[model samples]
Target: MNTHAMVMALALLISSAHLHAQDTVVIDGAVTDRHGKAVPLCDVIFNPSGFIADDSLYFKCDANGRYRAEIPAGHYNSLYSLDLPQYAKTQLEFWGWNLQLTENQTIDIAFDTIEVYSLAVWASNGGSQSLFAAFRPMHLAAAKLPRLYYKNVDGTPKAIMDISPTLTKSDIQASIDGEPVVLIDFHWSYEHAGQCSAGKDSPFSENEPCYMPMIIAQFHKPKLAPGKHLLRVRIQDHLSKEIGEGVTHFSSNSMGLGF
Candidate 1:
């Protein structure tokens, strides 16, 4: 072969090897609940970021909630799973952000079933000095609630909000800056599914109507000295009588803040 052609061939081979190295990495892990119980039959979604392609990836777990996959090395926004029939979903917590996965690693995910996994408190309006807080009452689906079942257009049983659980103002006990505060408005926030696909054999449907639940409440900010303040929240399931609580510290300047 000519000298110029031989050099070109060697350069091509080196470029191919570099691309291959950047595209292959083994990730294996198990999804478990707060008590270390397997959260079976769910797909873990990895959302990519930055200059990488917008296509997301899914890792299907076995009935034992264990998964292993080969994915491209890149920066990712977060990894999370959708709600299962028997368990409430988890998101954005404990999952690393701006994650750079470049080598083989084990990443275990834990869902907060029957506990308060995370809490965030922030100032809603600076002028009004009103504060807002939200928390996940993990494993909320386990609570007893009356279900109104109906068939879908395809004759499949449609998922309905009738089975969705809720908490009243009486169910939450919150305190800010060591003083009692009333949770005036109580509501639920949901994260809908989009542009993600699950394995055909997986029990979780990407199009399922039900999703994870979050409890949000608002309280009037007390007149405190401008500094860091403590907010404590306790939540209870009216049906199961289970309780979950979390604490967070925020500053007086914590407008639109979250923890």
Candidate 2:
């Protein structure tokens, strides 16, 4: 072979090697919370949009909130998964807990959530009764709040509400503790509100925006403001800040709030 041809062949080989090194590859990543820490025990599952369900295996985040999983081998062009709890859609609390892994790479995820502040709740008429009202968790607001439902005895808990823009909200159904319930749809709010009832036609039209006037009506919230007293526990989310003055009653004998 000619020397010139040999040189050209060597150049081609070098270029091919470089291209191979730069080729895209699958990936594995460790997911953690905002504190740059590890998640100890959260499950991570790959979405089936890329492949068969059995091929998709879930991983758990460790105590430090750190999780690791291999990218599945399949026809997937590229995909990823993070180890975290399923999303809470309300108020943006727990929506983005997971991460996606690209093919042939490692990722370090630092997830963050909105934090809330608060002060002690005091009612003018009551003697600082903190044993009744329950504070909602941040995840609850962050998650997709399923509207309770019961149609046939076997079709109960269908979670009938679908707030997506495409789904019409003209009619809604609810139930509590094996009984029928109703709520009023909101004009511009992400969530529906209304009074809960056990019988038929609501006081207002079924198409009205609201049915249960107060959020506490059918919730069995065990309110302490206007009544005598009842033992209840309130849990506050770190994300909902200062939970307002009279909104949530804290849990346990501890009122430190610790914020």
Q: Estimate each model's TM-score.
A: 0.42, 0.30
Off by over 4 Å in 2: 25-30, 40-79, 84-106, 111-145, 148-259
**lDDT score at residue 187, model 1, on the 0-100 scale:** 77
lDDT (tens digit, per residue) of candidate 2 on 144-179: 443334322244322223222111222222222124
Residue 2 displacement (Å), model 2: 2.6
- TM-score result, candidate 1: 0.42
Highest lDDT, which number?
Answer: 1
For each candidate, what is the lDDT?
Answer: 0.59, 0.32
Relative to the unseen true structure, what is the C-alpha lDDT of residue 231 in candidate 2, on a scale of 0 to 100? 21
Listing every candidate in turn, what is its Cα RMSD in Å to the true structure after a full C-alpha superposition?
A: 12.7, 19.6
Which ten contiguous residues of candidate 2 have the minimum total lDDT?
242-251
Model 2: lDDT equals 0.32
